[model samples]
Target: MEFYKLKANPKRLFLLDGSGALVSAFFLGLVLPSFGPLCGMPKNVLYLLSVIACIFALYSFACYFFLRRNRKPFLRGIALANLSYCFLTIALLCRYSQSLTIFGWTYFGLELFIIGILIRFELKYASVR
Candidate 1:
């Protein structure tokens, strides 16, 4: 689909974002610590980020439900938030470049890619185009 013309149904977009956040929260918060050291990342930092992800997930769910009436801003907010996070993660990855394993880098790349896609979708379709 052409990005300029692409528009996602608000409900579906919200569902997708909320679901992704929740899943990431679970994996990062609950499952990642055990493998952190093996992956060369600090367990404490991983743990902290995981908890932050969980908080984000909870807020996403709230936004999904509460922002239905005021959707354009909501969508914009989600996109901007994701964009900021994507950039932040990239910075963090760079800072810890020497510590991350191949798996860690690959995962970071994928995370950035997915979030970028979401930002694009939201920016393209969230407005009255």
Candidate 2:
């Protein structure tokens, strides 16, 4: 009449993903706007977009890290949120053609790489149950 429980170690992969998301958000929110004019972008628009990006980034990171230690539902919710932000960022960058600057391109590439790795990690461990 007793129930058993299962637990898993904290995976560093998620941490990496969280870090990447933070960096990306910082780049898009703070770094990008600060240099948007130099990059030949409209400062007002870019800065506004950067603000939005930052908000999304912070949300993603919080969701993941906050729940990663104890709640599976929260962890999954945050992971999905992070993934959504990743996709949205990519789409926004492509739509606006703002990925031309060296810094912009590099940040985008790093985010994509992190996202890919996160996905692979999830798939690899999908059968853990």
lDDT against the true structure, per candidate, is 0.71, 0.54
Q: Going through the candidates in order, what is the number of backbone clashes in each?
A: 0, 0
Index of the highest-TM-score prediction: 1
Q: For candidate 2, what is the total of clashing residue pairs?
A: 0
**What TM-score goes with each of the models?**
0.84, 0.57
lDDT of 1: 0.71
For model 1, residues 26-51, the per-residue Cα lDDT tens digits are: 76666767776555567776676677
Top lDDT hit: 1
Q: What is the per-residue lDDT of model 2 for residues 51-101, given as tens digits with 9 covering 90 to 100?
A: 654664565456546654444444455556656656765776676574366
lDDT of model 2 at residue 14? Answer: 47
